[model samples]
Target chain A: MSSFSTAKPLKKKFTERLKKDFKNHWQMYLLALPVIAYFFIFNYAPMFGIVMAFEKFQIKKGIFGSRFVGFENFHRFFISPFFWRLLRNTLLISIYGLLFSFPLPIIFALCLNEVRNRKFKKVVQTVSYLPYFISVVVVVSILFDFGKANGLITNIATFFGWDGGAVISSAKWFRTLYIGSNLWQHLGYNSIIFISALAAVDPTLYEAARIDGANRWQQTLHVTLPGIASTIIVLLILRLGQIMGVGYEKIILMYGPSTYETGDVIASYVYRTGILDADYSYSTAVNLFNSLVNMVVLFTANFISRKVNETSIW
Target chain B: MMKRSAGEKVFAVFNTIFLLLLCVVFFLPVWHVAMGSISDPLKVAASSGLYLKPLGKPTLGGYRLIMQNSTILRAYGNTLIYVVSSTLFGLVLTILAAYVMSTRGLLFGKTFALFVVFTMIFNGGLVPTFLVVNKLGLIDTRWALIIPGAVSAYNIIIMRTSFSEIPGEMLDAARIDGADEFKILTSIILPVSKAIIAVIVLFYAVQHWNAWFNAAIYLQKSRNLYPLQLTLREIVLQATENSIIADADGQDVMIFRPLIKYATIMISIIPMMIVYPFVQKYFVTGVMIGSVKG
Candidate 1:
């Protein structure tokens, strides 16, 4: 239709729209220039370099010039004895973290919500959130100090006639110490979201429950929990998505040779092999495997949550 | 609002006890560390149990030792520089990106937003990121810490959300008066966006302070450039093994280990602790906006 009669007019209209659009928003583009370039170089560039996992990385040869080893690095990672140990430890630690460390904040928030005393509630919330800001190094050091044979917590245990000797270094105690400290650190801070959701609950629902002669527990069960259910499910799905990606800094700080049985995670392993030991290609392959699994699990969780509960981050 | 029943009163009593215990559990460690850092080194070593108060008269020996240590001093300076420079640089990038994206008529906001969000879930792992930094010749340089994490995509999205909440009429009024994008941002947007700015700066500063892994990797050969956390970690690692060995018989090692370790921990965290209460309110709101809005 535009071949002869309307082609000229349509072309004119398109160019005019393009010119007007650019004229109006050139300043926005100018502002976005540095951000685009920064992301391009820092984020996208490293993404392209993920290929080094399949290649022999050499300093002199750089990424492209290096010889492609085709699955050799991945092969070594898969066949190595450390592979299964690493995988087992990573999975166990993640699962332990998911099991024990996940429900804490919700419970804390729910409990805090039930408190009738305003001043006491504020104090509890403020005091509880303080630990969240302490650095991982300091957090672990506190653990180490308290877990020493004659340290505070150990002494407390001894006072109660229980053995707490060298708990930090014991393999069996590693998961407990790690998850417990994690619970101590993040429980209050993470509860802020649920607390905010609680604060947003409709007042009419509570009044309605009260008019129906519902007790506090019944009201909480009927009105409060359902009010924040979507928030709970969304947060749960988000947490589940990253079950494989525990923060490695605290683990690295806390774990020792003796406790590696329970403590070594994928990130720390990657740090050891890739950065410390300089096995770049092999570690890259290992990390890529972890990341791919995380990506798949994350999307699967999101999909299932969306389909079942109609709640998701997206 | 109604009168409390017996069952409700029982539940409230139990809840109060539980929350009080929870509060003490969270607060006791920090209190103990703070108290122990100032306690006599010999007393700390010999006590072998909790001290509700300083034992054998508090001494400044531990802090004095940390202050005199050149490594700790240098790391302190390095951390300060990293925190300030990184916060400023990151804020600029974040604000610029967020403002542009929040603009009503940006050509491809959705495409750009997707580009940023995709990096959140998928990325090059450790080796590839290290390789990129190595290729850029940022290894062993201060720029390594400042450049790699300069603009957080999540923070940008949060700031964008904040900026978009600024009414369109405000921006349009400025534009009609012949202000350019930069002028409009400085005069109209910046003046009203203080809350988000303060929150982002605090967040970035805390992140820079807490970060050591990046510095450990990028500044592998440069001990002098190591941040405070990295230096503190080294001390803790060495002291851990030494203390375990010393627990067998060596009194001298035991005397100094906890003192030095606790002193270092307190020194590292003191800044954040000092500023936390003043900025505490913003943190809750900031986190809520980021999480709920996202």
Candidate 2:
């Protein structure tokens, strides 16, 4: 450290500058009060409550009064028969969703962007967004009704030389149906951001490519792909962050005992164990596990994107 | 253009055909529900591919049954109340927070901003959130649904971006003219940010209207207090199928499954389709705020 006699002038100058800045901006603190309070109360405050997950949380005794349970809640959940099956099913469903729903909106947007018939494009966009507005309960009920072995879809499948026999009940078809329905629901609405990203590409680049004798497909691959590459990467990373958080509402309503063999996911298991069974501590442990895995995936994804593609959600 | 030989033409034709077919597949469930709802139970059961052009006179019986269900009316009322109250309250808070964050040199504004972003990455999970809500006496009440979800981090981000784009000189001029912060917010800030505000309201409205998960968790009172979605869900799942079966009088009514599903879907989606177009312009204007802020 510099001697006080030598450093005194510099220290005084720094303090004086900081003081002036604070005095000039005092009103800013007043304006920031409500927002700071909101996040503190609603968000940061809840963080302390995460401790309950690790305890024998008793509502009557309170978190402070509850006994220190160590890892018992987690151990209980992991030892349950449903643990591995729920995880496998969750992974499979998410994989199917990734395969189906992920590419759909991007492809749809690309196709729609390419369409010369604007009316047809508009109609497609409208119908696609329409399904997103329909509640998951409605979507599931409708699916269930149409899923009965002799229901409309099943009967029609018979004419097409296929068995739609109890599709919802069959463990094999659960992921396909769920993923297929999801693709239908979100394809158009999710395409909006991709389309916007595509819009930002300079038309002059395309014109230059055309002048260079690049064909439609060639131009698309060379120009359009690079232009939307960052958008795709960022969105992909975001999607990875949500990998474990499957569509809980629709899954619960559509799935039953018959379909549980293939259809049960971590979220649904947590719901049944945590909410319906009222095993709060166990569900919290399982949910916390899912979140930890999700956080890892999110950061790894963000890091990899940053390294390989220079695109990240962070 | 890819200079197409005959093979390329065939491929292009195949691609278009495939897309069209996929579109039909996507639309089939909707058609199935609509057709099934109107056809007589006997006829619907006896046929396959129950088309929109009915084989016989389309019956209004299913709709009449829904209309007769008193719970549906009550739920509809509850949904409207929740939607209006939540949208107004959530929007007000989001705008205020966004405005405050947008203000120049807000002391520790950047740190305060990071706190908002912090929520996106972490949470206490459901049990703790439920405990917090319960501790606050919000559980079992409408306040649980509204207040807990009031400040969407996404909404605040976009609204903040919109507010920040307002020139500082304009706000200073308003201040010099003796306009308070609230007055400036209403007269100047809000007027300029109307487009983004509309998008957030639309997003929040749809979200609140579609939400029943929170209600399922929180509300312990009368089923009569159920929102339209929750009530209609119970009726559709618990009643319509079984009630129809019980009344079938040995007649096969299973075929009516797809029919009534369509009617329910059509009715449920009608509100959104009707309301959405009226606000299309504003929604399209600046929804890109979140992704592409300069």
DockQ-based class of model 1: medium
Error of 1 at B279 (Å): 1.1
Q: Rate residue B117 of model 1 by lDDT.
A: 76
**TM-score result, candidate 1:** 0.93
- Provide fnat values for all models in the order shown: 0.74, 0.38
For TM-score, the strongest prediction is: 1
Best by DockQ: 1
Give a tens-digit lDDT track for model 1, residues B83-157.
999999999999998898788766577787888777787888888888888888999999999989878988988
Worst 10 residues of 2 chain A by lDDT: A24-33
lDDT (10s digit) by residue, model 1, range A82-193: 8888888778878888787667788889999998779988889888888888888888878888888887666776687767477788787888888889889888888999
Q: How much does each candidate deviate at the interface, measured as C-alpha RMSD after superposition?
A: 1.5, 2.8
Error of 2 at A274 (Å): 1.8
